[model samples]
Target: MATGLILIFDKTHFSKYFVVPSTLGALLALAIPDLEGGAHDDIIYNGLNPNAVNNSKKYGINWGYDSHLFWEFLITHFLSLVLPFFLQIIQPKEEKITIKVLWKSIYLTFSVALFLFFFSWIIYAIVEKHGSPAQQISWNANWFYMGHKGISTLGELTKWPYNIISLTIIFFVLFWLVFVIKIYFEIYSFNLSYQNRKIRFFYIKRLKKTVFKENVIKSKH
Candidate 1:
């Protein structure tokens, strides 16, 4: 096996692409209530008729027993963001991986996760207590609003500027997740190619040495 050399991390590049976008993505994911939100009682009681007694929008992720700060934020959400980091930071460069980056990455992940959750909770609490949405914090009024009127018309749910901003953020996060997955696969392929080249080079060197020894022996004979 080839030994890897210590190298400096590209902190600027990492922060710009990896950390910042991930942080923003995570924040948006956590803060924004899921689209599949509905009141607890709003269920399809009958196949033909639906009971809208709860006035449930009938969508959004069920923020059930696992919605506590510890469960949702650090344990669930924080660890989830760290999964891609493990795959992406595969040290494929061999020489370009450093302890500083490793430690800094862990630190940044923890800090950013905490920060996002804190903001999410703060916004959630304020919105809950306020009874009505003061401004368009979430992109879709139909998506995650707790109290007051749910989306009456399609226009209410999908407006102009807010919709653009919200959809952009959502798409960004989706692309970012896909990107992380792609990076992992690309690194895996690169590592395999690198190992094959190294093996070929080693074999060629050994073959040259053997040929040189053979020639020397024949000359002596």
Candidate 2:
């Protein structure tokens, strides 16, 4: 998947525009989940590690209290889809890029990033109070996952409402993987194709070394 995305962007004229923005979007998708009331820690310590004590309980953190997993899944996935377009919208109209445009771009990128995060957080807050009985019960049950082999929510996913919620989360996770692939290509293509003097020299030197090793192996064979 990453190889395919790299080929697509590397062959395109707009690769530069795609790289930074898509990388940013992928990073945000990876990070926003951390704010879900430390459920990740619970999953690790409680679910994955049988011998480990229940960290959430020890720390007195209310389990799954801040997790509107379904909503979070939606917002971040949606934002990743639209982030590239939003970045384009904020680009200056002037043909020549200037310092001012650079500054503005930085400012707008941060603004959009913040807006995506806060918008999801706000939605989570508003609707959290109205979580269905199934959601509440499942969350409590799944929290501090008592030696589960999979995700904290894995057990809950077998039942109603939780089944639906888990499905939504899965949908978004697959959706976000596309942008993550682009991030890999962004780093890869930068190293392989960038023309900057220092970067080009470094990659060229590495390539020569690799080719030299391959030739030595072929000669021995």
Candidate 2 per-residue C-alpha lDDT over 1-221 given as tens digits, one digit per residue, 9 for 90 to 100: 22235346753323223434444445544544333334444455343552455554443233334656646655655655554444344542311122233334444444553454445444444545876533333333321111121233235663333433453355345434543453343334433444655434233223544443432343343
lDDT of every predicted structure (CA atoms)? 0.39, 0.40
Best by lDDT: 2
In model 1, pairs of residues that clash are 35-60, 36-59, 36-60, 37-59, 37-60
Q: TM-score of each candidate?
A: 0.29, 0.26
Q: Which 10 successive residues of model 1 have the least lDDT summed?
A: 1-10
Candidate 1 on 1-221: residue-level lDDT in tens? 00111113333234312433454445554664343433232233222133433424444334455556325544444543553354346643431223344345445544553454445455556666663432323412332212222322334543332443344445446544654554344333432235644643222123444444432343343
Model 1 TM-score (2 dp): 0.29
List clashing residue pairs in candidate 2.
none
